[model samples]
Target: MDLDLKGSKVAVTGGSRGIGKSIATLFAAEGCDVSICARGPETIEKTRAEIESHGVKSFGTALQGRDGEAVRTWTRDTCDAFGGLDVLVCSLSAGGGTNDERYWYRSFEIDLMSATRAVEEAYPHLKSSENAAILVVSSMAAAETFVSPMAYNSMKAALITWSKQLAEQFAPKGIRVNCLEPGPTMFPGSNWEMIKVARSRTYSGVLRQQPTRRMAEAEEIARSAVFLCSPAARWVTGATLRVDGGYTKGVQF
Candidate 1:
């Protein structure tokens, strides 16, 4: 089924690796002009090349996710490169550490505020598109924690709330805003060693909780994302689409 996304211009944050890279590649494959940003210049260029190889116009920049100035500059550069923008996929994330203060601040800036800046920057361009969509990539940890740091859960929760508000605010402009919440997904950048440690000594068993009994693939989440950004989901706004493998089945209490 055609998602009616050809010729659309898309901007993705954290698009240098992992889920972000997967989203960028998929968008390019769908015939959309794609632009992405990350901190590492080499990795950003590599992802840009990969997307361009799909025969769509692509650009990338080295910009720190936690920096507002960087976000503004990158957004400007990408929009100029693509000529226009239709979809904004905010997949920002950050590392969590054992140190309480460092963990809290980093999580707040990267996971939550970075997305805020991206959306704010892309609002003007998205408003000009016929089928504008904003997809904020969150995590299942927002609803229920697993092995993620406390900051991770908190920041994701903030994203859900922010998406809802933006959806309402943008409804008049015909822009649909939604969140994609994924559970345990097998992405390259994920710290598998940390997951292993959690599984061996955590409060909840990750594998056994999910009905699928297996981790999800990055493509699975990307498929949902593409659909959400497509014309098919024109009416889907202020919603959270859980791509988890039936991990949350009713109340456990």
Candidate 2:
């Protein structure tokens, strides 16, 4: 089916690697002009090249997600460069850490504020689009208790709430908002990869709970995201999807 995504403009925070990169690339493959913002220029440029390989225009910006001004600036630049914005994916995250006080601040800034800032900056641009959609990348950890209590888990849960509220507020303007809660995903250079090597017990504990006895790949999560963010899923706003390969046990009504 045609996603009706050709020629659309998309911006993805943290699109240099992992799920964000997969989402951006998939959008490009569907013929969307993609813009990515991440922390490292080297990775951003390389990923930008990969996105352009799909035969769509790609832009890259290097900046820390915690910097609200930088995030807003990137949003504006992306809209300006692409002529307008139709899709925005907030997929950057400050990974989970011990319940240190500082981790709270870090998660609050990068995990939560980054999405808020980008949405605020992109609101008008999205309002002007015929097919505007936003996907907030939370975690399955937010829907169910998976690890020790940490700021990452709570902050992600907050995103689910915020996305739902935004969906209600933005629907009248033709802007779609939805949240995706990905389960423990593994990929090259992922935090889970590092945890697998350094924290085997915790990693094993998580795998034991996954029905498939394996983690979901980033692209697998991105597939759902791309569909939800595309015009194909025009009526799918205000929904929170837990694409975890059944890792999360809680039933959603």
Task: Give the winner by lDDT.
Answer: 2
Candidate 2 lDDT by residue in tens digits, 1-253: 8888999999999999999989989998999999999999999999989988988899889999999999999999999999999999999899999799999999999999999999999999999999999999999989877689999999999999999999999999999999999999999999999999999999999999989999999899999999999889998999999899998777798
Which residue pairs overlap in candidate 2's backbone?
A: none
Q: TM-scores of the models, in the given order?
A: 0.93, 0.99
Candidate-wise lDDT, in order:
0.84, 0.94
Alpha carbon deviation, residue 141, candidate 2 (Å): 0.5
How does residue 32 of candidate 1 score in lDDT? 91
Per-residue lDDT of candidate 1, residues 34-107 (tens digit)? 99988889998899898889899988888777898788788878888887789999997884454377878888
Q: In model 1, what are the clashing residue pairs, if there are any?
A: none
| Clash count for each candidate, listed in order shown | 0, 0
Model 1 off-target regions past 4 Å? 95-99, 197-204, 251-253
As for model 1, its CA RMSD to the true structure in angstroms is 2.4
